[model samples]
Target chain A: MSQKRKLLVHIDALYRSALYLTKNENSADDLVQETYLKAFKSLQDDKEIRNVKAWLFRILMNTFINKYRKDKREPSLVDFDSVEAFHESIQEEVVAPSILDGESVLETLVDDDIKMALKALPDDFRMVILLSTVEGFSYKEISKIVNCPVGTVMSRIYRGRKMLKEKLAGYAQKYGFK
Target chain B: MNCNDVRKYLYAFLDDELDVEKNIEVLGHSNICCGCGRRMEKERLLQKRVRETVCEVKAPAYLEQMILKRTEEKPNFFISVVKKLMSERRLVSLAGIAAAIIMTVYFFAIPGNLKKDDFLYLAESKYHDYMMMPQLDLDIRSQDQEVIVEYLRKQTNSSIVLPEIRDNAKLIGAAMSEINGVKVSQVFYMHDGTPVSLMIICKPDSGSEDSKNVDFSGMKEILVDEKVVYYDDKGFCGHCKIMGWKEFGNEYVVVSKLNSDEMIKILKKA
Candidate 1:
């Protein structure tokens, strides 16, 4: 396959993440287009990219942060410091051992519910979550992609998943699903 | 492991991030503990739901077409060549020599027959080139004034002094070449997000044939700090302003999109 064709293979994954990050289809489309342009230029230089998916994602995330982030009306609700603060207080609010012992109502929570929950998250948390839970990038790969330490990536994933579950549980309860 | 310890590494265990020893420990504990096992299962189910929800989104068919079309467009030939050559340091001198020959032919082919407007055109063209691709042609990319001046002096074999323009402008870099045996240096700067070029040309000699080869008698002259300065507010090319002045027998020209007054206000510091 041509270099461009090989990159297009991951367009679905990139686009999906872009859609969730920007929360706008037009911005997602623009972001993906810009990413491909940069990737094509780099490929022309004959640089060897071992993992094209991760490389493409790094470009996408950097471009979003540098350019698109300027238009963001609100900053990431949670930063590394705040997330660390929450980590310190994790022991204070004891996570009951039996809190999630019963069957999950996640199946009853539809796609929209899941998306809204993801969107409601702070940009930082949602980024790590999408990269991990959806894209299946390892903690190491995600740390490289997001340009953060592995421990930070780990903390974000843990907190993000917990928050997502709470939002989904709220949605399920409103839907009268136990 | 106690419930708190198991929960601490629960997500890591579920994500397969834990090492073998830790993974086995979490697995062993959850196997015997009903609550922990159910919790792991619940977390797993939630992750699956999130994956299903997000992965359902596919790149629109048109997006692929749009990206392919855009990426397929060829980059500017000059820019690509310069960018490629910059990566290989050995070829840089050869590239510089070739570029000087090309520029010499461009500006000095009919030097004796040239008019004042031709100088303006040259200044405008060089300024546009520097602004469009600032990094590629620069021989020395430095913000330090002394560094750039020293490099230009060595390369052109001429004494070069850069005017300290204190208008929030930054000295980006400089490129030097011996055009038609006359040393020339182009210094680039950025002020208020706009690029400005300072072209410094070494005078051949007093009444030398090479000195009379290029004519500048037709340009509009003004006195700045008691020194005669040549300027063209009505630029030969587009709306860019071109100003030329003699300092210590060397020719200095300024070209930018700025108006004559704005250019003068900044050039007054020279």
Candidate 2:
């Protein structure tokens, strides 16, 4: 692939993965930017990489784990200050009252709740569930990305969803988020 | 099909992550079970909301443009630090792999050079140890040993006769032992000429022969095959297993001088 095309693919994949990981608009943009910088500097073996999307995802997940999980290890939501700020920032941009159905309204109700819920999950769980559910990666693909056993991937996705549902039950029921 | 398992995969289940058969099962279950169907519907709505909010309209336009510009720049110091860290990690992984190979060679590979006597002795000890306990079945402790013994006598035609063993073999008559927690009959046969002792142990607890250790003095080395001592329910192997485990309190241990196979043949005769 040409550098331009590769860049585009990298950009698109980063955008999607960053969004999934951060669950907030502004922070996702920051994450994607950070991922590319890191990916390029360590760009020794990406040519041999088949699934660029998953590879980028692994980077994003690792970045999240390194940057986010460590900070939140004490289960202190107070440490979630920056990401929460970005969420608030994104909310400001999307507050036009906008159309009801066409992603705008969709953006308003469950999007904020969903992102918070996803970000609220434990690091390992948040990544696995998003990659499998939102990104539609296979168990095998996820195993490669996360570099865990397939059984472990399945377990994380299962338990992660269970935990997410439980945490989101009230919000899901009240807002009709889905 | 259980509710717990269904709820576990409701999102992926709705997304068609499961194979077709399972998907169909989920759908069928959902249709019949209102709870599951609604949960599936709820998941569908959730995904739609997520994609709409996160992917399409979530991020700001200025952030996208800013990200595009910043994505290309790599600071030299950061790159060098990352490179150093990665190399160190690689070295650590290599060290781990080398250690694992050494331990594996020390343990499993060491067994290859063992002499036949060593193998026989190991096999005998292993077999005796395995047959003595109920490893697999948890509910075999209460099973009637007599029923299994009768089955064995009929199947092998008493080919595993114990009372009339040969001069070359020592008979360690019927005892109680468990295979997988199931109790069954048991018998022990050891040949004096060779060091091999064949133990007849029942599986799933053969109830009659629950795990009991026996020591019949002066037979030199006793080699038991732990793997084979297990019940092979197809024919009379179970009988061997049961008889091997079917001894009572400490009393009736009719020892003889016949070999192990001869003892099994005698049990078949009964």
Candidate 3:
């Protein structure tokens, strides 16, 4: 993809990542904006970043950590109860089920199913995986974004995927996967 | 490879994160484990399904407006930092200049111990919780009877240390209080229930003669819960008696309780 198109994709994806990190809309907006500012300045450097999307996500995630997580010393705000409820509610049928087949679910997919999956995963695991997978972040990039060892990034991804698959299984059994 | 290994590496392979060797091992295991193969396929489908379910959210229309406004104001943050650094540099230079001026003036300065004459002034301006003890009860612990006799001898000098107070008082018996530490002592006298305590200190600079309270006032007033003003002048370095009712190394409190009218009279005369 062209750099400009890629930057737009990155911007949208990082916004989702930030939203998942800080459940609050205002906070997510700020985190992603800060990510853009930093990414703009840092992109001026000569280092090679293999995946700009992942690189953007990592910067966004770290910015959230340094700005909000450390300052508040609390897990991201979560209401798993509501997440499960929303997922169950969506089982009646997606507002736009056909949107689920698109390469990037940017069209008209209900944000509820995604929100439900995100809420079920623990905050630390949820943020790391959402940021890495959706953004196609490499382990090294994720390690920097999450401010952890590459091993830790791998462990979290592994565990996060496991938890997500389990939740999806439950969703399938309880609500049936579309 | 067992079903467990198949399950573990299956996700890794789908993520395109497994090396070729691990992919070979996982593919081998999955071919033998029917359940693992089905599960691995479902997991891949689920990964795709999740990405498809999550729609990207864009910044609201106002986000652009906010960024543009903030950008114009952006240089202020860096400019403030530079301003702070420049001011700090100037302050350091000014302080260095002041120190040099002080050093030059020190040699010409009068014996600082003589400055004790201003004590009454600094003490009045300083924060003294005189309310902590409104009554004065003094006792003397002087081994030298001659010192008490001589200090009291001021009564015979016909010079009223506080002349206005002379109408209601003469130098009564010079009493002393328990000397606790460092030649710490209090000379006491009563002008009709108005008390006067002189906290005598044997400072490092001994040659200094008896100075009045007004001389103490000339020194800068340090606002503190209780200040420890270090006076280094005239070859003398002694803490200006802490001006407030504060617990210092010890309570070298010059205990005095003069009523409002009596205090006014004494201060007026002094």
* CA lDDT of every candidate: 0.67, 0.48, 0.48
The digit string of per-residue lDDT tens for model 3 on A38-65 reads: 7666756857777677677767766876
lDDT of 1 at B215: 24
lDDT of 3 by residue, B73-159 (tens): 656788888667668868788778888888767534532322333342222211111211233333333434355545533322211
List residue ranges in candidate 2 displaced over 4 A: A10-13, A19-30, A41-46, A68-110, A172-178, B1-5, B8-12, B31-34, B57-270
Q: Residue A46 of model 2: what lDDT? A: 45
lDDT of each residue in B1-270, candidate 1, tens digit only: 877778878878878888999998998999999877877787788788889989999999999998878866777999899778877885879788989998887555534223333444444445545332332367778999889877865665455556656657788897665544555666777666555666666644424222322222222333456665554334422224445544332233223232233333444342
Instruction: Please give the TM-score that candidate 1 achieves against the real structure.
Output: 0.56
lDDT digits (tens) for residues A43-105 of candidate 1: 889999999999999999988877776676335534322332323434643643223334445
Ranking by lDDT: 1, 3, 2
Q: Rank the candidates by DockQ, best first.
A: 1, 2, 3
What DockQ do you compute for every candidate structure? 0.20, 0.08, 0.06
- Candidate chain B TM-scores, in order: 0.43, 0.25, 0.29
Q: Kindly list the per-residue Cα lDDT of model 2 for residues B6-63, writing each as its tens digit.
A: 6645655765677888888777888888755765665666567655554553334465
Best by DockQ: 1
Full-model lDDT, candidate 1? 0.67
Candidate 3: regions farther than 4 A off: A1-9, A41-52, A76-111, A169-178, B61-65, B84-270
